[model samples]
Each structure stands twice: as structure tokens, then as C-alpha cells.
Target: MKLDFTLKRFPINGRLKEQSGLPFSCVLQPYHRLPEKETSAGDASGTRSNSIARCAQCYSYINCYCVFDTAGWVCSLCNRHNALKPQQQKRYRLDPTVLQELPEVRSEVFETLAEDPIPVPMPALEGSPAAQQDPGYVSGPAPVVVALVDTAAGEEFLELVRSSLEAALEALPPVTRFALITMSNRLGLHDVRASEPSVRYVSLLEPQLRPGASAAAAAASSPAVACPLSDVMPLSSLLAPVGSFKGAITRALEENMVPEQGFGETSDAEASGSGAAVGPSGAPGQEAAMSRNSGGDAAPGGGVGARSGRSGGGHLPAARGLGPALVAVLDYLKVLQSPAFASVKTPDSEGGLSGHGSGASAAAVVGADHLSQNPSPVKLLLFLAGVPDFGVGRLV
Candidate 1:
């Protein structure tokens, strides 16, 4: 399918006389819904003779081009995380929406892991038991609850994410509990039980995750619990807890440890060696903790996600750690992509590109943010910031 493409310039933050801006040059990739046709490969000049390259207002790269019949492609410089703000002279940049409304435009809309188990009982321990339970069975294990916390996403994006997750979960046999948390220093968790089941905004213990805050502040404010994705409670019973979620889980699990007894010091040495906090944790390929804050808390109470909190100030400094984020995402994706969580049909399976032909997959949209960095899990976050810009194109 030949999808449409357009360029939209976003304002960049800048000081006097200096101009800065990030341009989102977007292309609507061919999806199942769009019509299909073979694309004529670009000629020697890197583009068809009929197509022309144009400067995207927000990007510094000159590669932004408008093609006659193909998905759009943008330059890397303008769409990065550390993109700078534009200067005063460049302030009144062209809006992406206007460019998209051009004559030929067709209006369209769009949009892991398992771990070892611990023997634990639910708070509702002594109930009437199960219909198919043993004559005198004490209790069965509590079902694990997987709560996904997406940071910096806006309301629409968060809702879309929530819906996607729910859709993904539908394919699973049956899960005990599941929740969603959206954070950005502040918190917004949806009430899973309410009649309308809407997202509730909460006072995030940390402010650093907000767009302007530093990374450090965000890290510090992040909750250690896996429950209630945000800090909103009194406002609603279905509160989302915010803080170092992975930490809380780790800390809770570490409380109970089994001492090792080995025949030789070599075995003992290896056991001890494995437990130390060596260097930094959670680098993409490195087998570190799934979360930066909670290396010690992979397994804890019923595995449903819990909570513990204390308010703090300022944004956490940009830690030189990405491994944990990568690990967290990979683990999450493992579960998300699992047979249990596979709700939507994959693009590749239906014969589009690899896996995004319907282009319904979240990774397709998220990939635009980080695929250029290195084709690993690090790219998952760029879209987590979920600020709406142009769809992903030629400026003119």
C-alpha cells in the first residue's frame, strides 16, 4: 500500500539568538487497511526524478523528502530525545496539521516476562475454597498481577496504551489481576473496577519525570510498588501508586533468603560472587534487574504488585543507565508477545512489512522513536513520552 507522508516542525527550546527545534518527519507506512502496490525503488540520486527533497522545519537534516507514491522517511537529527528548542526567529514554525490537510490527503486515524514462583497465600486465604479443590485443600497460589507503568504518556496515549494492553490480555487464558499505571513524575492510574473505568490523576511523589524535570528527579520519585500505577487514592478507590516499583518488589522478596551450603569454597565463592552489585545494572544485553530501582525484588507477595511510599523533591539526574529500562521492556515484551498475551494479529503474519502491515502493533508506532539509535529495546521509550506530533514524512 502506498501510505501518505508529511512533515511537521516542532518548536525547540532555545536561548537568545540560538535556534533549536525537533522536526518529526513522518510517513504512514503501508498497513492492511491501505491499498497495496509495488513501490518503484529510488533511482541513483536516492529519490525518484519526480520526487524532491525539502528541509523539514524542525529537523536539521536535508534528507527529508516528499515522494510521489510511498511511505515517508524523516532524518534522525530532528526527532531525537535530546532535540533542542527552536530560536525566536524560527518560533512561528508551520503546524504539522496544516501540511497534512493538503489537497490529496485522505483523512485517516490510527493508533513480558515470567519469573520463578514463591509459595504465598492471598489475603482472602480462608474462603470456601474452590469448586474443584481437594476435600481439605488449604489454599492455591494467588494469581500474579502484571501492572505496566508507561512513563510520560499523555491522556490519549495512555488510554490507547491501556486499550492495547487490554486487547493483548484478552487472548490469555485467565489472569487473576491486571492493572495499568501512567507516570511522569506525577501519576495517573485508572480505576480497574469503576463503572466507567477511567484514568485517575494522582500526585506523583516525584516531579522529575515531568517534561521539564531532570531525569534524577524522576528516578527518585518513581514508586517502589507495582500496584496502582500512580499516587491517586482518596480521589478514587482504585489508586495508582507511584515510586520505585521494581525496588519494592525486590526489597520485599529479599527479606526471605536461603543460605547456601556448598561442599567447597569454590561453589560458595561462585554463589557469593553472583549476588554482589557489580558495576551498573540493566544494560540491554546485560542480564541485570528488569528495573533500575529494583534489582533485589523480582518476586514478592502473590506477584500482584504492591506498594510503599514517601514523598521527595527534584528530578533524578539523568542516570547513565539504560540497561535496566531495556531489560524491563524486553521482559515485558516477552509476556506481551507471548501466546497468552497475543490479541492483535501481527503485521508480518498478514503479509505487510515484517510485523506491522495492519500496522496495528504498538512497536510500529514506538519504533519511530528509537529504531535509528540501535535496533534494540532502547527505542521503546521514545514513544513512552507520548506527545502528539505529526504521524511520522515530507514537510511540503
Candidate 2:
């Protein structure tokens, strides 16, 4: 392939993203080489593309030819109008002409990421949990809820979880947003997005080596390919208000949520019996195996998910993947909070992104005045009776 070619010189004239005949290649490459006078990538001409606004619909780089008004900017490519982010509105406040100061607007050529601070990529976890299988997970941004459940807790504990979540439902305003995670031997995530309840289980235990397979091969053979958390589920599917999800959330906990049976020092017979009863996803290549169990709790006194007499000294369940589970919950919230994605409308504001529904609304009303001067966008209300014993931060 001819990698190097004549580059479009910057500071030219009229251009639009729709001007396809224009040599985007030349504009993207800029020149055969950096100028000798250049000191660093930061100092290069056309490098300020980072701050250059983009058409949210077409995602085309903003160019000089596009029309910008106080309300929004028209996409040069698709003729779509996209609202300006808060900071972009500031530029419009100063002078619309300032928008042209961007290198892409002046160059009449395509910009490139050849220089700029590339954000460090997040480390891969596993095939995204159950939420990702559905195609419409992030169709658009919305609110989110991650119910972190300790599956090892007994019936009383589960009753508390049920009652608490039910109460949370009553207190929460309507919008379809929720995900329940049951942590025990594996991390079980509920598909609260749907009307029919289901939980996708992921074993935290390291996969046993397959006979006659190399370590490298074993690692590569995982059934689910690792992807960024954002791609794990659809934003539209992930978020919606509480009122829409009250029934489904309640049903999910009652019908689908259950503790993994073989946690800690259970007898071999019990492990075998329970494993036979509950069905596992058994997806190869991943350390986690998805399980969905319907059997009643076997722990003495009929506790929800806990074993009454664990041989282990620790009071905590050995199988609860609390650490990694918490990480996943936070990541979900963080993704929703991001402005680049998860754009949501609030009751107070017609446009903009919201990380939490009720919380966001509360903040808008009394967060600053009554709550805290510096209110946190995401507040994690975790329900755990014990520490984690599996995956990233296993205490045992």
C-alpha cells in the first residue's frame, strides 16, 4: 500500500464533510513529514482537533463549511442538526467565527488522530456479562442501576434484599433502568431489562486446564471475545426510569436470583447435587461460566444462599466475587456518566447527560443546597454481608 502521499496543506479554504471528492487522504496525512521547526506533537499545526466539535449524528469532524447557531450546529455531511455540548456553547458565546479557528475548519481537509493524547485503554475483563448479548444495549444513553447482591446470604438476608429493593422501587421514580448481580461462587447478573426474568452466571474461579491444550491455546479458546465495557450492553437497553422497571425488578429477585450452592467448604456430595440441579452457561475459553439455578437454598434453616456450617474459618463466603463485581458496577455507572456516550434528558433539562436518574434529579433540586456542597454524581449503595473471596480481590 502507498502509505505516504501528498498531504493537504492546512489554512486553505472552503470545505465540508460532504465534499467526498476532496482528497481526505491528503488532509488526513497533512504532509510527508513533520516540519523541522516542530518541537513536539503538542506543538504541531492542526493538532488542536481534540477540542474541535463533531456532528453527533454523522460523527463527522466539524469543518468550516458547517453552519453553527446558538442552539446547534448543522452537520456538513448528513445535514443533521446536533446540539452543542456545554463547552462548545461557550465558543458560540464568544464568537461563531472562533469555531473556524480549529485546524480542520481552516484546512479544508480531514483531520487525523496521528497526534493527541490517546486515552489509555481499559483492561479486558471477560466476554461481557449477559447484558451484551442483546443488540440494542447502548442504542443511546440512559440512567442505570446496578444491584449488587450477596448470594451467599441466607433467607433472612435475601428477604432483606427483596424488601429493600422493593422499597427502593417504591421510592424510585419511573424509568426502565436496573441490573441485579448475585455474587457467590460466580457472579450472577440478572437480565432485568426484559419482562421474563433470567440471570447470567459467571464463575470467578480460574478455568481448569483442558487436557492436551497449551496454556496459550486455552486462553485463546475462550468462547466470548473480550470487548470494552461500553459495548457489553446497549445503553438504551441498560437505562430507563424506575417506574417502568418496578415489576420486572421485583420478579427478577423472586424468580431468578439465587446463591451458588458450592461456595466455600461444602461437602462433595452437596456440590455434586447442586451442580446437577442448576444449569451453567458453560461458555468455553472464559474463566466465568454462566449459571442459572432454580433450586431452593440448601443451607441449614433454609437461608437464601448461605451455607450454615462452612468448614472454613472465615464468616464470609469463599465464592463471592465481590471485588470484580464491584469493579463492573462502577464501570457501568462511569460509562453512563460519560458525556461522550450515555446522553440522557433530565426532567429539569431537555438535553444533556445524566449518570443517575433519581440522584441526578435530587442534585438538580437540593443536592447543592441541602445535600453536599460537592455532590457525587454516582452513589453506590452496595448490599453485602461479607467480603469477596473470588476473582480480582479475593480476601481468602
Candidate No. with top lDDT: 2
| Consecutive 10-residue window with the lowest summed lDDT within model 1 | 304-313
Per-candidate Cα lDDT values, in order, are: 0.28, 0.47
TM-scores for all predictions = 0.22, 0.41
lDDT of 1 at 298: 33
110-168 per-residue lDDT for model 2 (tens digits): 43455444232221222345222221222222334567788776657777888888887
Listing every candidate in turn, what is its Cα RMSD in Å to the true structure after a full C-alpha superposition? Answer: 22.6, 18.7
lDDT of 2 at 229: 32
In lDDT terms, how accurate is model 2? 0.47
Residue 236 of model 2: what lDDT?
Answer: 37
